[model samples]
Target: MKYPDLFPFSWFKGFRPESNDNLETKSPLRQLADIISSSVDQIDATFKDRGQKYPNLDAPFDPTTPAEATALSPEVIHCSSLIVAACAHLSATVNIPTKLLFDVGGGFHLSAALGVIIEGNVVEILHDHPSGLGVYDISAKNGMEPTRLARLLRLLATHHVFIETSPNVFKNNKLSSMLDTHKSFDTIQSKPEDKYVGTSGISALFAHTCDEVMKGSAFLTETLTDPDIGASGAVEDCPLAVAFKFKKSFWEWLEEPRNEYRMNRFMLAMEGSAKLEPSDAILRGYQWGNLPPQSLVVDVGGSLGHIVREIRNAYPGLKYVVQDRPAVIESARQIWEKAIPSISDGSVVLQVHDFLKPQPILDARIFLCRGVIHDYSYSVAKLILRNLRDAATENTELLIIDTITPYACLDDNQARVGYGIMGTETLPPPTPLLANLGKANAVPYILDSQVLVVLNGEERTIGSFTELLKDSGWKITRVFTISGSSGKQILAAPV
Candidate 1:
């Protein structure tokens, strides 16, 4: 049985997925594994930092009251952090003049915040522990003032992360949705009827647009909403990349902190989402025939061309063309030319084309898009799909690789950043919401709501994607699974 896409989704209880190991259903186990991994120490230190006596190992995680289980209730703290992150997102919404200054300031604050969150102390521990040793103990020994810690924890709470025993208690109902990553994804894909895919978890919904997509909207939502924050631009500047508005002094402090780990974590967190959908996995096993011969794949916005390069090498006769924004394509062209002479010669064409506009190549048999189309307003993706459809012929194959939210009508209810709203020409209309967004498919509608709040765009579900294709003039052939439970390699054709 598939979980239905229901609003105010409540998978908290009485929820089931068609497949027992379905990632959405199975992730809690994985999270438990990760929590138990090294984080147990972090949890231990957290209790120490909070001055709570460690619970006996055999003690049940059950705490009579939320405050009673500090060590056992890391999840509660995580739930609280969701609020802090949500509110903290406002740091980016300032006008370029401010954004220009704020990111540098914000970055430092965030780094400090992160250190405090992870290690329970904000001293030079992260760097001093060159071996990454037990610096948590060292920091604790050195002495962290109580008043400062309280203030810092309070700041963290503003981001929506609340500490269990802290004097501060957050009241935001919505913050719970975004705190636990697994819960957040379920909420994003949940429809009005599917409690499993309910709206309670906001993390995935927040991730789609609110948290990482853009600076403005994320920051503005928090800033405008905050009572103490000084004047920020009116709400209109929320999503724009007006990063130059902040002070130069802020930028000066910000330049050095842009490290590799930070860049990769934040970047991949936003783009290569945790939920690996079947569509993405399916792209892995396909027979490309021969490579370095014909351009077998066009990876639009394919970052680093890692996937495309793999496909190219796997089938030496087939060549690859990585079409992305100017920066990405140009960078790829130069990097490949230097690394692999063959790719730089002529086999790979790193062209610049916006998916929201007309697709540059229509002749390729399989036109593949993975983790690309979900980055914009729905209206724009349709334009891109419409272009692809207009570019296709009877034999031309359209391979759209992305996460497909569990089909709402079916009893399946798993949701992870997958929106079926690409206008893929089939699967449309389960229900509607809001006067402006109109009726959308189960997963797409939820993703759309997220886009409205966070980054001003969304992820779609299979049904919405089908509808979108139809709207843009295409037809769905099959929605088949690949390796990952969350992803799918969607097959469609131009009508």
Candidate 2:
């Protein structure tokens, strides 16, 4: 199969690949690591300036009394914590090249192949075999070579995907067991009726990410540099479109008859992501119980009504209408009717509606859009918000549930100066760390890049979100951070 073109530097005239000798000096991670190392002195100086004895850098700083609090500025403690966190980030970022190199060199293929192997009951056979299956035995069972299989298994084991017990012998571990097709049997009870190739949630998600998303990611630079598509926010100009040389948007491309299997896998991956994501955040983050009796909540772009169903179970007083494309609505109708018959009785309505178009439902109490806006560009996101804004009354609340990409150094006093952007509040860290939680917010940053590469979209900063909402004639009322989860809930109302 033809892969998308790898990131080409030809478009960037002056761009030269950094050599190993200069990589450290040129690395942002190295700069961060240096900052962390130098911060220790600043911590000591702050203590001394405050007429307090400096705490040993090697010792843990635990302030128990008022005197201790006075001795150490909250800044010092925060900086110390940040140092620890930054070190970990530096380590991880430095090692990223190894992982990237592997991915470039058939890592995705290896992972998918492994998923297939585990899906095929090869792991179960090995488990049952007791002595552990050798390369020859496993290869014979799967119709592959002993040497190649051993090498692949060993490479995977290096990353803890499986256990290579005593060199050639291999066995499934906790991590690898997740790929087992029967893993869901205990929870699902019955076999999955879906005809998707890989039924395992993780397997499906992994396969989809590696097989589809990775292909698009490879040509991200090429997509950006193409004169016809440079910096275009249109979905048709997205990296995925450019990579596949498709004239249609990502959704339209997926709708093609030739991409049936790909579509199924993509849907399965979404389902899988839903399972892994903190869906309960919606339940805990919002006050659904506070809504008036029989208030209608429209779930915009809610695939298969999964989120609505979960919310409904918690707050049954509120009625729900799950809106999506016709096919998704049909699938949702089938799934919900079979699982929740009452959903068919108008209590939980499945509406076949495109979010880009004006919302047909009027006067909805709540318009909940989760994991939707990040799939579009700023222009498209504005269009979506505007569509909702038109249908929404003054009382209608627009709850956006998605990742709120945090800005770096928001807590720094200098950084906040002259930054009059709304929703850019400086969150106080527990002294001595960088204000934006530093490495803790790494996933959101990575996700921001993923959205950019895949959809010509973004995981917006609070400021960006505020700007987008303001432009669409809506004002953010409040932002709620879901505890123990990366998802955030932004509540807005029409201006």
Candidate 3:
């Protein structure tokens, strides 16, 4: 009856119905409040234990500080998730239905305001003005109307993004500073096309999400109601196609010459997505060091070979072949040839290969697909998996690294038969809380809608993954949950 030592302490003990936990007898509201209070206590103690103070929201963000990494530690992350989930659930429990609906429906305005500020370089403009900047001064610098800019900024300030100092004056806070590209306002103004070229990619992510995904999502109902496209499951029939009137799939549309800026922004936005997860997330599950020396590990659809480079850096003996579209392979060649010696010595090979076709590297000891499958519909995902399966030998292992969503309610069946070993258990949240941990596990659900709007894809549950792999001639062997990452590593072998 003992669970795996996944957490620091046995806090999860007695949460089940069969256990002697007293939380089950309390009112749901009280239980949620207790969850928040206890989680905050844990977070407070941890910060004090490390001789660090909890970060202040009023101050600008400083990622260079060692406390930034400490904030992302697994234990802290879990506690934070519990607090967020409990607080949100409690708020919903007490709020009026009409008011809750209004807030949920009006959420797009936040995205619109964020896009305006990021595009206007407001964060960069406010970077030097630590004290505050008046609306007129900001308008003079950015050319936006003073009153209109004030209204937009006030909206964001209300949401705790920026901070309003005095009347008509605003300053960047920690939440808003994340959008700062650190570029000079002049450079951003002069080279509009290159604003996101050398930055942290956060601004680019904001631009793409607010501009493209937000626009496309507006036609979600229309796309769903249309019989011809709704049931087709074709990427060309997605909501983006309906909103933009484009016949091509999302990737093909990005390739058009007129959309070069958008294409570049999309690429950088993906890099920003990777930054959202832990840097060592990819190394958590699989035993890369155990592979034979010089074993070829082919990274399929590996844009810029970032994942392969990380693996090669950690486990140098394993050779790699990073395959992608021609343009991506050329980009990898250009970026890596100068920076990485592995490319020069032929230890890492960059080849252009489409996953829709049969894989070329038949001798691969491991076929690694990271964050590639979720960008396609089930039909397209099947094509990618079947291709890998066709090329995989008896000894070749396939590692799929992506999010595995959990259900909201309790599940006895999945807990019993899901992809886990005898000793390790995937712990559920305590009673009176959502089984999936609700808002704490909100990223994958947000990404589900994200893929639907952008590429007609989806984040899958464990059952969905099992069905897909079974249909593609692979059998699941093990699943390893990565610490501080929404994504899990699912290892399978050719059936």
What is candidate 2's CA lDDT for residue 44?
66
Count backbone clashes in candidate 1.
86
**Could you tell me which residue pairs clash in candidate 2?**
74-431, 75-432, 77-431, 77-432, 78-431, 78-432, 78-433, 79-432, 79-433
Give the per-residue lDDT digits (tens) of candidate 2, residues 1-495.
Answer: 111111110111211234546654555766565547656666666667766765332222233543356433435544554565567557656677877566557655665566455444455446555446787877765566778777867877776666777879887765565554443322322333343344536566665666666677778889888898887899888877778889777778898999887788788877776665555767876789999999999999998888888888898888999899888888888888888887656888888888888889997999999999998899999999999999998789999988876556543532453134333344443222345555544567667766776788888877788789999989887776543355668888899
Residue-level lDDT of model 1, residues 44-134, one tens digit each, is 5666777776543222222343335452242433322222222223222334667557644574454355344333322222223323323
TM-score for each predicted model, relative to the true structure: 0.48, 0.71, 0.92
Q: Alpha carbon lDDT of residue 328, candidate 2?
A: 83
**Clash pairs (backbone) in predicted model 3:** none
Report, for every candidate in turn, its global Cα lDDT versus the true structure.
Answer: 0.46, 0.68, 0.82
Write down the lDDT that model 2 would get: 0.68
> Candidate 3: worst 10 consecutive residues by lDDT?
1-10
lDDT of 1: 0.46
Highest-scoring model, lDDT = 3
Please identify model 2 stretches exceeding 4 Å from their true place. 1-87, 90-132, 183-200, 410-441
